[model samples]
Target: MKAATATILVLATFTLLSSGKKFRWCTLSDLEQRKCAELSKALLAVLPLATINSFARVSCIRAQNTHDCIDKIRVNKADAVSLDAGDVYSAVKLYGLTVVAKEIYEEGNCVFAVAIARRGTLDIQRLRGVRSCHNGARWTSGWNIPLGFLLARNELLWDEDQPLSQVISQYFNASCIPGVGITSPQLCALCQGPKSYVRNKNHFCETSSSEPFYDSEGAFRCLKNGVADVAFLDHLTIMNGTDSDQEEYELLCPDGSTAKLSAYGTCNLGRGPGRAIISRHNFQKITKKFLTLIQHLFGQNGKERAKFELFTSVPFRGKNLLFRDATQHLQLLKDKAEISHILGLDYVALLKGLGHEGSSLDNSVVRWCCISNAELRKCEEWALNIKSDPLVCVQAASMTNCIELIKSNEADAATLDATHAYIAGICGLVSVAAECYGEGCAPAAGRTKKLTHLADKALPPVYAVALAKKNARHVNIHNLRGRRSCHSHLYSPGGWLLLSRYTVGALENNTVNCDIGSAYQSYFWKGCMPGADKNLCKVCIGGGEMEGAKVSSRCAANHNERYYGNMGALRCLVGSPSGRSFGDVAFLEHHNLLKNIESLQSSGWAMGYTLNDFELLCLDGRRVAVTDWADCNLGPVPPNIVMTRPVTTTKIYGFLMKSQETLETNLDSKFHLFHSQKYGESDLLFKDATQYLVHTSHLDYQSILGDPFFQLAESVFNCTHADILEFCKQDICTS
Candidate 1:
């Protein structure tokens, strides 16, 4: 039986060697190479026991470091390599490599990165100038996870343009982070070099075992020896290396509290993925097959372990040489599993915060949110032509969704009308800039003329006018309770909320509990208030009678509805060529009322509409010329403001201000920052009559909206009664 086994082993080894199929494992140091060489021989010796066909012989490939190994694997120079979770993030993200298998320790396929400190020696909140120890420069538990936690929690202030090591050196008094090198010597101040080194005169911060404080065990040792106040390492390392009194050590959690070592699961910096075997994306299948075969042969219960152990580095006189010594088996990941799924979103976000994986932390590019396809097209054109700052366009289903997107960091900024701006502010957003009109910051005169700029002048507030057709003799503001009304949108400052407050609430005293939407639904006979679901949506012309129009988009609180904005409300009163006018009065801002009418004359829907065709319905129940809006208007309306998260207010304002200046001076430029007529839409992003953007970073929502408009907003959104505002507050609390 022994002779037959020997014959089969010889045949299998000869077949694998002669087939020229090889699995090259990348090694970072001489020690890892020697261990990999032993693993290769062991795999060859047990080849006959593996069930996989077309077996490949194992070979060791030497590389300078983990990043070099990743590059080699990317270009097909190496087949596979075992990497810590941090390097795995880099390998998969920067190189597009895929994980084939992960080393399963007693903690399963994940490990918790914890900060270990002697009892009463450290406080997580006051870590500045404290001596620290890390496993390695970019290792998972040591550098990335722990520092990333600090960065995320605002404990570390990184400019992202500089190296994170410089920030770390300035933060901690000294650290033993192996492989950080001479750029920051304080990082390697606590490292102990090899006791018996043959060469490499400078081994203080070497990545290999030559540096005594190079990994989890070394970091723990540094803390245990009273050299470092705190040691960042994995829970497994603390559990395995803690031979002294258990009560002497504790875990420094990110929440500024300390817990016993056994409570690491909840008190650690962050949970990280285990070490994984990575290969080229195309080589994943073969890599999985090869790993499965090898693990089955030399794993814990393998028949050939008596000859060569797979998970141990004691014989090689090193710790975690080729693979972690604590690994019990290899767990093959699903073929379709992505790197983000393996590392988890929280850890991935932490890495992103540190600028280690995925998109960099550069804030130069501003992502603008668009709520419609037409707006997206105009935004794309703006992104392409803007010269001062880079722009990227992100789309949302509605303006409220855009607000949520900006809050969640998925989007950066968006242009919102006064009402939506109020909602955005309630949801933790701030106004960064406000749209300014023509010369003297007044409304634009005409569409063809160039907009003039006056830097020192304050932007003029808009006027809310109740517009009506000159032919409608019986449609005065006082007798419009049973007549159809066209409003810009639901909860609009000028068209709906304030209009209701002054007209229905003041005149009739019928605004019960500040329910403006309910009041409007009961007052108006039938109309188009974009977000309303009652008779108000009955008159909305969704998609404007075009072919293949979506009926579901009717009364949508976005550009999808024909009567959705100031211009849209005007269109509702003007009517389409194929359809008659649907409303008796159109309430909207008077900023671009005449310009909108002139632009509508050129469209197929309202070919004959002109400035003289409409008149304003005054609050005194008198009808007057549309040009008398200053005296015959309902109230003053605030300008549309650009909203962004509070943290990104300055960045977003800078980008917008630069873009506004750049686009305003380039007369020969085809792309206009405020023009949306060429895109077959009006006011797609910013209002078409906007002259420039005024920086409002110093102003809050109330300041930007002005005292009168803000007071009206408070009355309209009384928290407990206003359903939209209540929902927004609930969302904020939950989120």
Candidate 2:
């Protein structure tokens, strides 16, 4: 494993660093490429605002992977190479290199190297004794080894220290010169498309190695024509297709959202040693220059990337899952010429069998569909009736057109299924209807007449309210008076109203919290989108299906920074990352008691306080809920955020502590969907699950369980110890 013979002369060809030009990192796709474009926008903005031309140029560079990028970098081409996180370490190791700048683009090593070949050689599976082409011997030291990989895959490895054409002759296998590179051909392949690869390469083959394919264009062409079933490519490469060429991609960069590639990082760096960089000086300069564009990283400039983070994380870690606010930090990196996040997403996915796709986050690329069958049927049916000569053109699969239909009042709403409802609802659309199972609504009941586009609707047990910030006003938040308030139901009507003032104020002050400034969910759940409306909802959760959970609507704008999804975010604020560890006094205060109730009662609302200080409220002829719980402090090392709430007490009862770990365990699939989570239960939700917790001390749920949802909880409540056995009666009932 030898390196370059001499210390490489460091020269930056990018005008951003030398020609006094800008730095650009381009890509294609809605997530990665969009993120790069967004970040680039911010860097561009930073120069004029800060009055600094530190970066001669700032732009996105589009390449296949790290190797190609490093090669380009070696030629003093691109200032910095943007690769995924996990592979960065590996590529550095493989290429035996170091880092200049880093940013956590994606969270994991999802990228895999695939061997590709002409259709005749499609069986190029485990290239054992068969001819194989790869970057040469010297490069394979820390990277890919054709022979070894073949052995593992149960194939033949016919590796030889030679160029690709020669290896093809001797061993019917060949290797690209180690570090000699494949980029040139990759580009050519893209232009010719896949058709040419088959006719040209004759018997082409590739080794699953790393990224920045010198010949990505070539490989793309090979795969396109079916010449190659698969290719040694990065995850992003497969996702974005290709820019067609350089200048064309640059045009798309400024166009928005279309420029992203893969979401997570890839791992195929040809199994390199370690990566090296030009020198620390260049690294420092790049870092310092990028740090100034606080807005790009944290602001609207990088929205596409933020959208990816939001979408991927929701399924990865359920809705109530917690994570530290990365907004501010990301915003800080905007201005510089080139910035990257080396460390990646540390959180792992809690995969749920989520969609039409299986519970395979790895094999699947989640796409939130904006239209559903029922809705599409309705649109077509109505299209027949309209008879107007307006352009009825649809981008076909365009979410933009779908969103515009609702926003511009051209259409009443957009519709989709439950699993996909999240996509429409997340950024900014209402899920007026609930998430429902797929119902083949192919043939409409009223074929001749236009009908409301509603599918197999989940019984509307719970509903969401969505609104755009620019449209609505009257947002508010309680003074809180330094009191820690655990405000759950972030987008709930009551929750939104309560937090409005604070959210609006935050936006006024330039904080990202209210970036959208007091928007509503309008039957939408999971999360919110940027420019959505209520009319977009077409999810039809028709009446009773699976039992909905027993939840209470409580309000107060509290604990924004404290909890995520429902988990703790930071250990503490105003200190080192770990400085604000839980203090010992949180329990003794029992802040959950009458403290807030007393304050509320003092203000006028009357309620009967009960054991554990539970309080029930009577507003207008119906009973409302109000309960108190202790706020967290540092005492006892491990602190339990005392539980007390009016709505559903069973879930949060019994020692649910004030730590992120506890939240994860409780909200886990087994314990959630509104089931009891026990005190001191370990990570697993199965063993020692808590049963029968107090819903509310003051109001016996059985008294007036008027709501159908309450009726179900009541039904379960009526069940006795005998009933429990009967319900679970695994006994063979042979009658």
Candidate 3:
């Protein structure tokens, strides 16, 4: 059984390696690129050892640095690259790369930051004047790990008035830290520069092998050639670069004990994270196959272990590339989630401690808002339009999710109805803009001018009218019993709210229940009230014939609900299922009557209905024209308001306000920004009737909804129990 397992592993490796696919590996230097090409050929040759197989190809791409490699991968220009802990942090957070494989060493997957010195030349403590050699500044092993430990242990005193590099330089008599430039001269004070400070020269301070005293091997070379007393490097470098016969180098253990190079793991200054092979998050399937094949051929017990030395041997002499010199094997990583698992939290924190200045953190991009599946298409279009200038993006879910998104900093702004706006205010989100109807009741020149044409301002309330077939004389205000009805969602002001007030207040002698939803459900035989409990969806045929989950799903509050918003309710009124479940009346906004008449042919549900087919039910007990809503409408409600988090900066506000200007000034014929029909037949992220977005910066929730209207909406929202006067107040503000 075990033999079969081993054979299967080997055969799988050979088969995948011979697939003839090109795997591009990113490298920093030409030498490394050449080495990667050689390694690729060697890896391909291993498949033939067991039997003939396909030849897998490897291509090397050159990048300026570790960060540049991540950028290349993000745009799909390159496939994969190896990165240190700091670079891995940037890759995951900024470019969304997945860590596919980890480079394992002899002792374990990780190597430690170790300090090496000639015997008796350096002490664990009280050696402030000793000279030092480092691989480079900003490196995990050479700088952050060791220096951070010393500062934490109080062995090194930090001077607040001076740069950290200056303090470190003052502590050592002379030091050679490659990559430290003239910005901090103290850091470059002891660097012995070559004639031109170029490659293939001695004593040039650079991160690459071009400098004699660069990288881990170069730092140790500074000590070997008697230029510096002590060198800071990883255990792998000290062991790989030193001779077996040489007794000059010793590791400085944290316990103040000197040990042989073999004992460096326990005697190290601090443990450092290993390098990771990263690819785009979406390329996991292919990357996994590639990683598995490489591990099988070059692993500790592979057929070509000696001849190719894919993992154990250095492919190039001058530089590190493709894989590090001492890496024993490549171990597969489960996901990007393993980044924090492989690199301990302390080490990860050490990398993030660099702060957000000039790092991968981008604060300039503006995050737009979205809620539910209905708005996804429109939000994505908006995101694409402002992709460059003051870049905008959208991410939010349902109305409830949008409130949470604002609180969690995931989204910046959303446009909502009066009821939803009030809920957002209670949740601590404030209204930033109000929807202007452009009815010409107020002038359009000033920013803070009073909106005269807007309804539900504590003046005359926006009307909510009931619609029924013109010939349905049997249904009336007093005898509306056991009739199929349609509503614009459960919480909508025009639908559920107005009807609740009528049933619980005006018909007090007949209405018994105080729970408005329960009362409505019992009053109507069966109805389509999206966002209602399951019992309310009993009669929904889901476009008159579909059954089971389809009908059930069509009863939700979001776009999935077939009979959800204003247009959906109108569709329900005109919709009939071959003499089966058709709504007798529809409770919706008065203006929707006109929209329904115009869309009779394009909208499938209103197929047989005409402009004169529907009539409005008046409180005066008369059926009137759909245009006679002014006298028959229930009451006025507030318009939708755009809301956002209470941000201290004007960045988000400026983005939305600018978008408002572009949308209003240049309304595209195919795509109206404010009344966006791009997503569906109904209004999407913003209301369809919206003429423009008006800035209401200084207005609070009370001011936006008007004081009288705020009180009315609050009473309806707080109505939890049964009492004719308590459930339905007569003074429910007319507006």
Question: What's the true lDDT of residue 505 in model 1?
Answer: 81
Per-residue lDDT of model 1, residues 474-587, tens digit only? 889788887888998877778876687555682333335346666777788899988787788889878777644478778888888777888889888877556774788999
Stretches of candidate 3 exceeding 4 Å from the true structure: 1-363, 387-397, 441-461, 506-512, 541-552, 576-580, 664-669, 721-735
The number of clashing residue pairs in each candidate reads 1, 143, 6
How well is each residue in 512-585 modelled by candidate 3, as lDDT tens digits? 55456677777777888876765567545543343233644566666556566787787777764354555888
lDDT of each: 0.76, 0.26, 0.64
Report each candidate's C-alpha RMSD, comma-separated, in the order given. 11.2, 25.1, 18.0
lDDT of 2 by residue, 1-735 (tens): 112211111112122354455554423222344455544454445334433354435665554334455555544455554333333443343343345432221322222333434333334333334322332222222123322333222222222222332332343232332232344343122222122244222212221122222233334444445433333433333344354422222111111112223321222322211112221234435533443233233433433344333212233322101111121122112222221222211100100110111223321211111222222333333333322221122222223344333322233233222211222322123322111111232235534211122333222211211111111122112222222222222221222222333333322334433332222232222221111223211111111012231111011111111211121111110111223222110111121222332333332222332233322211122212222111211111111111111111211221221111233344333323112122211111111112111112222222211243233222322331222223222211110
Could you tell which candidate, 2 or 3, scores higher by lDDT?
3
Cα error, residue 567 of model 1, in Å, equals 13
The CA lDDT at 34 in model 2 is: 46
Top of the candidates by lDDT: 1
TM-score, prediction 3: 0.46
